[model samples]
Structure formats: C-alpha cells, structure tokens
Target: MNRITLVRRGFVALALVSLVSLALVACGDDDDDDGDSNGGDHSTGSATIGDIAIEGAYARESVTDVAAVYMTIKNSGAADTLLSVSADVGSEAQLHEVVDSSMRQMEGGIPIPENGEVTLKTGGLHVMILGIEGGLKAD
Candidate 1:
C-alpha cells in the first residue's frame, strides 16, 4: 500500500477502535445498580439500634424549654419493648403523657406498648425537657 493510504487507514482504524472502547465503557455504566433500591432512598437505612426502631422522629418547640422525640418501636421478636430515651442540655427529661383538660392540665410518664408505636405529640403526650442548655435542634 502507498504511504498516504496506509497512514489514512491507520488513523481510521484507531478512531474506530477508540469509539468501540467508549461504547463498551458506557454500556457497563448503564447497569441498574445505581445504589437506588426499588423502595427509595429513605428506606435504605434501618432505624433499629438494639431492640427499638424509632420512626417519624421529630422534636418540639423551645418556648417553654420542653421538647419531644417520637418514634414507632417495632419489636421483631415476641418480647416486651422497654426503650429508654434521654436528651442533653436539660436538667431532667421525663417520659410524659400530656392530657388535655378544659381547665387544668397535667403531664407525666406513660407506658409504651410491646410491639407498637407510642406517639408524643401535642394534646396527647410528649417529653418535658426541663432547663434547656445553650442550643437545641429538632434534628
């Protein structure tokens, strides 16, 4: 073959080989394993620590220096779920069941079910954190 023809053929071959390699690499990347499972992103992490799984967890306002942490403790086995909770930046943290009254109001700790959820919301029940510290976040 002529020198010019050989050079042109070599360049074309190199370009074609490069395009084929690129196509292979791109195909491998398009696999369905993008770390996003079928459920969702939030469903990836399990909420269980030891014997409790806290779900829908949130905190309350700080106007009265009191806050709450709510969660659904699900027991995977046939056993009683006795979970204890605490918080920093407070003198005393108590498990309180807030009862709404027309005239007088009351608060105290209550029992949580074995394999169910116990809500600590307004007008139902919540945790009364006494003597808050410097800063408190709802996180």
Candidate 2:
C-alpha cells in the first residue's frame, strides 16, 4: 500500500460517509399518515398574520443538522406569496418541495392564491431548516 493509494482510499471513505448522511436526510418518515410528522405536542397552534393564517406549525425532532417545518397556510384575502421563512433555531431556512421522491429547493416564493390554502406536510412542501443550532428537541 503506497502513500498515494492510502490517500485515495481515505478520500473514497469520506465520500461514502457524506453520501450516506445525505441519503438519510433525504429519507423522511413515510409512515406519517396524518400528514404532520411531528406527532402530538409539536404544534404551535394557529397564528394569524393579516389575512394569511398559519396553523399546525411544527417541526419533527432532528437526527442530523437539518429538520423540516410543516404547517398550513390559508389566505382569505387577495393572492399573496410566501417569500421566505426565517427562524432563530437554524442558520439557513429554505422553502422546498418534494419532487419525484426528492426535495428540491424552491426558487422565489410559494404562491398563496386567494381563498386557497397550502399545506406543508411530510412528503410535500416544507421549510427546511439547515445548520440547526442545538438540534431540534421534541417537546
């Protein structure tokens, strides 16, 4: 085993570990039958922001550096958009949608049509919290 070969083996091992971590993060709880994945006591209830109401705001306990936030957004007034999401628990918050069994970061904002509602749930549209500080504790 030469020095160059050892270095290449090390790099390969590191890459494999990274890929496994990413795969675990991408695999969400598919058995969440109730849409919400956080189970009981995770909800923050409902909050009204102008004509837009956000309900069932919750996040599942994170096993890694990322967690997804689920909620229901209802717009009773004119059409609007969810430009972004910010939280003190994480360093980066991104809007993502599940496409073909993969989570894709949504560019721009998610549109909220008038008199319509959008549900962010498991295996659907959600807010991904990356670089979670102190991790997400289940309460």
How large is the C-alpha RMSD of every model relative to the true structure? 26.8, 15.7
Tens-place lDDT digits, model 1, residues 46-82: 2453444544443332333433333344544334423
Instruction: Give me the candidate number with maximum TM-score.
Output: 2
Using lDDT as the measure, which candidate wins?
A: 2
- Please write out the lDDT profile of model 2 over residues 70-138, one tens digit for every residue: 678887977777766655555776788987777788877688888999998877788777786556555
Which residue pairs collide in model 1, if any?
Answer: 95-109, 96-108
Each model's TM-score?
0.47, 0.69
Candidate 1, superposed: residue stretches over 4 Å from native: 1-46, 79-84, 100-110, 134-139
Model 2 weakest lDDT span, ten residues long: 1-10
